[model samples]
Target: MAAPSAARSLLLCVMVTAFLHHLQLQIPPVATAAAASPNKTDGRDDGRGKTFSLTLYQHETINKTAYMVVDGVTGAGVSQTTTPFGTIYVFRDDLTVSADRASRVAGVAEGSSITTSLDGLQSLSLAKITLHGHRGHRGSVSVLGGTYNTKPSDYPVVGGTGDFAYALGYVRSSPLDLRGRTVTYKMELHLYWPPYAHYAPVPHKPV
Candidate 1:
């Protein structure tokens, strides 16, 4: 009886070992750390962030897109080329794909500039650039900063809405044409969105 009991216990131990081995074989292997992480090289969720650039042409003309509704202490009117200190100029400029005014209209830049310098060479500008026509580009970016009349100026991108949500960057505005009653600017936007901000890459036209 003792020998039979010993043989039964040995058989049970062998069965348990075989069952564990079979279970181990049936289970799948654990994934490696590199394989489990999201791919970062393709400008996606790699924890770095995404960047985009755009070049737009802004056209402003007196009595059309630009207006001086408020007169300064010096009594400068809309017809004047220069504004005096305390003058408020409002504009709803046309943004085009190219420098030509007849080119495809991409959007609108609506904002106001208050003359801050006595010589009217500088002003505080605030604008909301609302984009349109282009697919995958559906939003507005807010720009605000000081602008110099004679030289290129950069304004900070303070906020955004719609597809440009959580946008951050700066706009480098260079005067393309500042003749007669019309003024044109080449607006180069260097934009960025954080990793947490959802965004899709939009096809951009050549600058």
Candidate 2:
């Protein structure tokens, strides 16, 4: 009787050990680690990317930075009164760090605005903003959208080059001064780069 009981006990212990070994084989090390730390394997980690922002001032003056290249049927040059529909204006305005024109030049805002509305209060604008050593970044961002004369307007950043490669975001333009001959606009830019297009600083080539 004692021998039979010892044999049964040994058999039970062997069965339990085999069952645990089977479980160990079923769960992989990678899966176990992922389950232990939920944050690392979740979908939220994939969406992470880089972002950048900037604020610059654009000064527009008649026959200077702003000009009417294509005149509508109403007149030949920029209209002092209400601008006629179909009129087009081109600008290569200086972007400054501050509202003062004497401030450090950050870049240039080159684009065109076409009068879309009969009231001349709104226009379709397309612009390319080039940055020069502003915040240690050098690149150009392209923007296009409708610009309202009275209120602030938002333009989508469609593409970019150089340091701003694969950039995506928007620009908010607000008019600071419009009463005088020189109109000052405050441009607030919000830029983003995808995870794949990581921002790698370009090496300076000696001129």
Candidate 3:
């Protein structure tokens, strides 16, 4: 008996996504200022301010020239490998975020993500995201990290640069389209930033 095409496709997607997740975990995490101090961002589960959501529509293109193919996780390749680190995949994205569906693009996100295979199904991933807004006065923010198994389905927002300095939170993404080589992702972000620059301290309410 043979499996259905849709089911097979979905299964393959899941397997590939899982493999990519595993690949992401292998990348060494860069130590951020926020990460260095455990006391500051104490609770990874707890963050400040209201939970704001951003609808991020992402488009990626994969090819061999985007990234230098390395021999292993840490090796810096002198020459390009035929495959995307043996997977024939490397993509750069100029994603846009919106407040509404098909509305004017609010912000521009620029970054590149790579997928590498260790051996067989074993794989790795590396992604870097930087965000900038046109209408806002506040500075931009960036998210840098590796993902594994795609489980937890969410990764920390880590820290940011500019007016949004010291920002920390988490992000989760869902696939909107899977067109074999190309994929579209709808990413939802939950960010925690420092309190208002000039705001009154809250007096405790009568209990």
In order of appearance, the predictions have TM-scores of 0.69, 0.68, 0.46
| Candidate lDDT values, in order | 0.76, 0.76, 0.46
Candidate 1: clashing pairs of residues:
none
Residue runs of model 3 more than 4 Å from their true location after superposition: 1-51, 64-90, 97-128, 134-138, 148-152, 195-207
Point out the worst 10-residue segment of candidate 2 by lDDT.
38-47
- lDDT for position 119 in model 3: 25
Candidate order by TM-score, decreasing, is: 1, 2, 3
Q: Would you give me the overall lDDT of model 3?
A: 0.46
lDDT string for model 3 (1-207, tens) is: 355988999999999999999999997776443244333322233333322335566654344214434333432332222222333334555555642335454444454434444322223443445455433423545565433222224555656666445666656655565444444566666555554211222222212
Candidate 3 TM-score versus the reference: 0.46
lDDT of 2 by residue, 1-207 (tens): 999999999999999999999999988697544334221212222222455667899998888788888776542234443466778889999999999988999999999988888777778999999998787778899999988876788888888887877877678888888877888989987765554223323222212
Weakest lDDT window of 10 consecutive positions for candidate 1: 39-48
Which residue pairs in candidate 2 collide?
Answer: none
Model 2 residue 189 CA deviation (Å) reads: 0.5
Per-residue lDDT over 38-143 for candidate 1, one digit per residue giving the tens place of the 0 to 100 score: 3223222221245556789999999888888877775333333458788888999989999999999999999999988777777899999988845447688899
